[model samples]
Target: MKSLSLLNKLKDYLKPIREIIYGLTLHEMDLETKKARGNLDQLFMLVVFGDLVGLPLLPPYYSMRLLPYIIPSLERWKRSVLRERDLTDFVSTDL
Candidate 1:
């Protein structure tokens, strides 16, 4: 069962990416395991593309491939983290 879940597949798919993400992000992340697991997309965008929603130069095909599996989290992640306008958003909510 674990083998089929997209999250687990993503772990295997992007193992190298994990290393890159952890190295580039703020050390304050304190990435033991679960935190890193939860924030994979954030780390990818931060470390590789430096964008939030979409990358201007990167092709959409890659994202398209991973999109289905991460859909549930993506929706919430976009709403809570990516959709917010600016720094003013921080103190406005529980985020």
Candidate 2:
């Protein structure tokens, strides 16, 4: 019982310290990774379904075949592709 109590206290004491270390060391890297992944997902969507938005990179038959798998994210992909961007959008991600 004493050992368990001490271990719980140690964990509670270290929790904030561990989070602080992660915030300082890993948070930015995690954000960058997520950003890169989202960009790649959008790019993949563009290649597979660009015809929907008028770019026509793939044949309609192929896009149609993949349509069911892609349906859930289609609206989000379209919005991201069609939205306006500016220099600030690029600048914010770098910092």
Candidate 3:
């Protein structure tokens, strides 16, 4: 409720809602992103870069300000985002 107004005010500046949802679809699938596991990174990026395409989660000020809170989390998120999972990982691990 704190900044819901800001979000509504900036609605026009948001990125394409659909692309924010799908931008990392293939990459995420390829990484075998666990359910609920990739949600935050995608959410963060969607906020950080959403305007590039229409549906940003938070206003830019909030997004930038929120960055500090997620700094440590962001590093881990980045690791997960950049992690490469070879097909062999699936082949090697128990299914």
For candidate 1, lDDT tens digit of each residue in 5-49?
A: 978778786988877787778444554465666567666544334
Model 2 per-residue lDDT tens digits across residues 15-85: 89999999999999999899999999988887877676788888888888988889899888889988999
Total clashing residue pairs per candidate?
A: 0, 0, 6
Candidate 1's C-alpha runs over 4 A off are 1-31, 45-54, 79-95
TM-score of each: 0.33, 0.72, 0.36
Best-fitting candidate, measured by TM-score?
A: 2
Ranked by TM-score, the better of candidates 1 and 3 is: 3
- The worst-scoring run of ten residues by lDDT in candidate 3 lies at 46-55
User: What digit string (tens of lDDT, one per residue) describes model 3 on residues 1-95?
Assistant: 85998888678556666567666556466555664456756676656555434666677677767766666665566576688998885563423
What lDDT score goes with residue 76 in model 3?
A: 68
Give me the runs in candidate 3 sitting further than 4 Å from their true place: 1-34, 49-58, 88-95
Q: Model 1 Cα displacement at 90 (Å)?
A: 12
Query: Which residues of candidate 2, in runs, are more than 4 Å off?
Result: 53-56, 59-65, 93-95
